[model samples]
Target chain A: MNKILKSIYMPILAVIIAIIIGSIIMLVTGFNPLAAYASLFIGAFGTLPNIANTLANAVPLIITGLGVAIAFNAGLFNIGAEGQYWIGAIVATWIGYSFKGLPWYIHIPFALIGAMVAAGLWGGIVPGFAKAYTGAHEVITTMMMSYVAIYFSHYLLEFGPMMEKGSVPQSPLIKDSAIIPTILRNTQLSYGIFIAIAAALFVYWLMYKTVWGYEMRAVGFNQRASKYAGMNVPLNIVLSLSLSGIFAGLAGAVQILGVQHRLYDSFTSGYGYTAIVVALLAKNNPIGVVFSALLFAALGTGSQYMQLNAQVPGQLADVITGLIIFFVAADKIIEVLKSMFKKQKKEELAS
Target chain B: MKEILLNPQLWSATLAMATPLALPALGGTFSERSGVVNIAMEGIMLIAAFFAVLFAHLTGSAWLGLLGAIVVGMIVAVIFAWAAVTLTADQVILGMAINIFASGFTAYLLNTIFGFSGTPTDTPMLPNINIPVIKNIPFIGQILSGNSVIVYLMIILIFASNYFLFHTNLGLRIRAVGENPEAAETAGINVIKLRYLGVALSGLFSAIGGAYLSIGLLNSFSTDMSSGRGYIALAAMIFGKWTPFGSFGAALLFGFATALSMQLQNSAMSKNIIMMLPYILTVLALVGVGGKSVSPAADGVPYTPKK
Candidate 1:
C-alpha cells in the first residue's frame, strides 16, 4: 500500500514540476502561462467534442504505452514500439484496402489480427536475435528496427503496389465495412477507445494474474535465479517482447480503422516514441498507463488550440512533455524534491 | 571497366559517402570498447548538424561551423555521458530521449530562427577544395583529391584511432575499463575519466559526421537531416563488434545501400523496391551479424566506484 502511494505520488509530482517549468518558459516567451494552462484545461474538457478528441488521441497512446510498459517490466528495453506500430498500421492498411471484406465484424478483426501478427514478428525478431545469438542489446536493435519500420512504412505507402495510384504518398482508403464507428457525433473518437481500455484491463490481468506473467516477472527480477528455478528466461523475454509488439500493433490498427480511415506515409507521427515517456511516467503499470496516456493526450490535443490561439509554436507541448520525462527519469531530482518538501514541513512545524 | 575503375570522381564520391559513417563508427568503437553504449550518436550528429549550419551561416566560414558543431557536440555528448555514467539512467532510454529532444528542438529552432521548418537559409554552402597536385594525379588522386579537409581528417583519424586503440596504453586502458571497470580501477585507472574521454571522442566523431552531412554532402542544413544514420552507425558499431576497420566495413555496406537507393530513385529501374533496400539490408544485417558477434562485457553498465 505504501509502495502504491509512492508510485502515485512520484508521477503526480513530476507533472507539477513540468507545469511549473512550462509556466516559466511561457513567461519568458511573453505569454501568460496561466492563460495557456487555462486554455489547455478548457480544450481538454470544454465540450463533448473536446473530450472526444482528447480520448481519440489517448487511445493509441494508451495502447503503445502499455506495450512499452510490458517490455520494460520484463527488463527488456523495447524501443522498437515505433517500428512495431508502423508495421502494424502497414499490415492493417494492406488488409483494409486490398481485401474485399464480408461483414464489418470479420473485416475489422482480420485487419486487427493482421496488424498484431506483423508487429509481433517485428518485435519478436530482436529478442530472438538477443537470446539466440551474441546477447546483443535489445535497445540498439529496437532503435534500429524503429528506423527500418519507419522507412519501410513510408516506402510501402508511397512506392509500393499498395500506394493509391493518384496520391503522392498515401494508401487507398479502407473499405467502409472495416471502419471502426465513431463514438461521439462529431469527433474522431471511436470504438478503438473501448478497445484500448479493454486491452489495458486484459494486459493487467496477464501481468498480475497469470502463470506466464509470473514466469516473465520472475525473469525480470533475476534472470540467473529464474534460470536456476527452471524457467526458460530467453523464451519469456521473447514472449514479453512479442506481447508488447501486439499492443503496439493494436495502436496502429486503431489509428487507421478508427481515426484516419486511410493510411498515409508517416501517419502515426512519433506516437510510439511519445508513448515511451507515457509508460515511464506511469511506472509501467497498466492502470497508470491509462491516466498517463490521457494526460499526454491532453497535452498533444491541446497543442492544436495553443497553436491556433497563441504565437507560440505547438512544439511547446513536446518541450514540456520531454522535460517531464527527463525530470521523472532523474531519480535524483525526485529525491531532492522529497527532501525539500520534508524541510519545508519541518520549518512550518517550527514556526 | 578500366575507365570505371580509373574514375576519380567515382572513388571520391564513394569515399565521401563512406567517411561520414566511418568517423562516427570509429568514435562509437571507443565508447563500446570502454563498455559504454553511445546510441545517442544520432542525436549528437543532429545537434552538430544544426550548429554547423547555424555557425557557418553566422560566421560565413565552414571551418567555424565545424568548430562550433564540435563544441556543441561535446556538450550534447557530455549530457549523454552524464546521464548514463553519473546518473546511471537507462542508456537506451536516455538515447531515445535525446534523439526525440533533438528532433523537436531542431524543429523549434528552425521555426524560431528562420520561420520555416523544412530547410533553413538558402545562403552560401560549403565549397569543395581542389588540391593542386592531388587533383592532377591518377585514379587514386582523383578519388582523394577534391573533397573537403574534413574527409582527409577522417582518413587520418581512422588510422590514428586504429593505432590508438590497438597500440596505445590509453587504448588498452579504455578496453580494460569496458571489459571490467572494477578490475581496471583496482589497477589504478580512473574509470570515470576514461569513460568521459571515450564519450567525448564519440561526440567529436559524431560532429564530424554531422558536418559531412550538412557541409560535405548536402551543402546546407535541413530539418531532421541526419535521419537515421546515427542508428545505422550504431548498427555498424555492433556489426563491427567494436573494431574500427570492422565498423568501417559495416558503414560502407550502409553507404552502398544508401548510394544505391538514391541512384535507383534517379534511374528508370525498379525504383520502388530499390529505395527500400537500405532498411531491408539493415534488418538482414541485424539478424545476420547480431547472431555471431560478442560485445564488451561491461557494455551499458554504468561504472560506479566503490564507496
Candidate 2:
C-alpha cells in the first residue's frame, strides 16, 4: 500500500506544481489567474453542453490512452497509436459509409469492430518481427509503422477508390443510419462515450482478471524468464500488440461516428500521439487512463475558451501539456520524491 | 535510355530533394553511432526551419539565415542533451516531448511574432549560388553546381564525417563510448561528455538540413513543416545500420522515394498515385531492411555511473 502511495505521490505533487506555475505565469502576463481558471473551470463544466463537449473529446482520448497504456504495460512503447488510431478511424468510416441497410445497433458495432480488427492487424505486423527476430525492438518498428499508417491513410483518402472523386483528399460521408447517436440534444457528445467507458472496464478486467493477462505481465516483466517458464513469449507479444491496437482503433471509430461523421485525411490530428502522454500520466492504469483523458480533454477543450477570452493562443495548451509531460518524464523527479519523503519524515518527528 | 541519360532536370531535382535528407541522415548516423538515439532531429530541424526563415526575413540574406539555423539547432540539441544525459530521462520520451514542444512552441511563436497561425513571416528565401566553372559543365553542372550552399556543405560533410569517424582519435573515442561505455570508461574516457558531443554534433548537422528545407528549399516555414523527415532520417539511420556511408545510401533512397512522389505529382499522367509513392516505397524499404538494422550498443539506455 505504501509502495503504491509512493509511486503516485510525485505525479500528484507535479500536478499541483504545474497549476501553481500556470497561474503565476498567467498573472505575470497581466491576466487574473483566478478569473482565467474560473472561466476555464466553468467553461469546461459550467453547463451540460460544456460537460458534453468535454466528454465528447475525452471519449476518443480515453480509448487511445488505454491503447497506449496496454502497450506500455506490456513493455512495448506503441508510438504507432496515432497511426493505429488513424487506420482504425479510416476503417470504421469505410465500414460505416459502405454498408447501407444495417440497423443502427448492428451497424455501429460492426463499424467499430472493423476498425479494431484493421488497427489490430496493423499493430500485429510490428510485433511479428520483434517476436521472430532475436533482437527486434518494437519501439523503432512502431515509430516507423506510425508514419506508414499515417501516410497510407492519407494516400487512401487522396487517390484510392474509397476517396470521393474531385474532392481534395477526403472520403465520402457515411449514411446517417451508420452514425452513432448523440446522447445529448444539439451536442456532438455521442453514445461513443459509453463505448469508451466499456472499453476501459473491459481492459481493466482483461489486465487484472485473465490468465492471458497474467502471462502477458509475466512476459513483459521478463521475456527470458517467461520463455524459460514455458510461456509462449512470441504469442503474448503479438497478442498484447493486437490488443493495444484495438484500443487505438476504437478511439478512431469513436471520432468518426461521434464527431466528424466522415473520413478525412489527418482528421484525428494528434490524439494518438497525445494518448501516449495520457497513458504515461495515468501510469498505465485503466481508471487512471480515464481521468488523464479527461484532464487532456479539458485542456484541449478549455484552450478554445482561453483563445477567445484571454488572447493566449490555443497552442498554449499544447505547450503546457508538453511541459507537464517533460517534467513528469524527466525521471529526475525521483530526487524530488526523495526530498519530499525526507521532509515528511522531519515533519513527523517534529510533531 | 537516351532520354533518361539526357535528363539534367531530373538529376538536379533528385539532388535537391536528396541533399536535405542526406545531411540529416548522416547527422543521425553520428549520433546513433555514439550510442544516442537522436529522434529530436525533427524538432531541431523544425526550429532551424523557423529560425532559418526568421533570420532570412530579418536580414534579407540567406547566409545569415543558414547561420541562424545552425545556432538555434545547437541550442535545442543542448536542451535534448541536458534532459537525456544529465537528467537521465528516457531518450525516446524526451525525443517525443521535444517534437511536441517544437510543434506547439513554433505555432505559438508564429502567432506571437508574426501574428499568423500557419506560416511564419514570409520574406525572400535563400537563393541558389551558382558555381562559375561547375555551372558550365553539361549534366554534372545542372545536377550539382547551382544549389544552396548547405547542399555543398552536405557533400563536404559526408566526406568529412567519414574521415572523422575512421581517421580521428576523438572520433575513435566517441565510437568506443557507444560500443561499450564501461570499456571506454576503463580506458579513461568521459563517456557522458562524448555522447553529448555526438548528439550535439548531430543537431548541428540536422539544423543545416532543416535550414536547407526552409531557406534553401521551401523558403518559408509552415506549421508542422518538418513533417516526419527527422523520423525518416532515424529510419534511414537504422536501415543503414548506423554507418555514415550506409545511412548516406539510405538517405539517397528515401530522398529518391520523396523526389519520385513529387515528380509524379507534377507529371500529368501519374498525379493520381503520386501521394502513395513515398509511403509505398518507405514500407518496401522497411520490409527489405527488416531486422537487419543495428544500433550502437548503448543507444536509448542512459549511461549512469554505478554507485
Candidate with top lDDT is 1
What lDDT tens digits, residue by residue, belong to model 2 across residues A134-200?
A: 4566776676667767767766776776788785768999888889889999877999899999989
Task: Encode model 2's per-residue lDDT on B233-263: one tens digit a residue.
Answer: 7777666777778777777776766656665
lDDT of each: 0.80, 0.79
Off by over 4 Å in 1: A20-32, A132-134, A336-351, B1-11, B117-127, B137-142, B266-291
Off by over 4 Å in 2: A1-5, A16-39, A131-134, A165-168, A333-351, B1-7, B58-61, B117-124, B266-291
User: Total clashes, candidate 1?
Assistant: 0
lDDT of 1 by residue, B206-296 (tens): 9989987887677577767887778778777767768888888877776665655445454323444554554455445555544555678
CAPRI class assigned to model 2: acceptable
Sliding window of 10 residues with minimal summed lDDT for model 1 chain A? A127-136
Error of 1 at B19 (Å): 3.3
Q: What is the C-alpha lDDT profile of model 1 across A1-21, one tens digit per residue?
A: 998897788778767887897
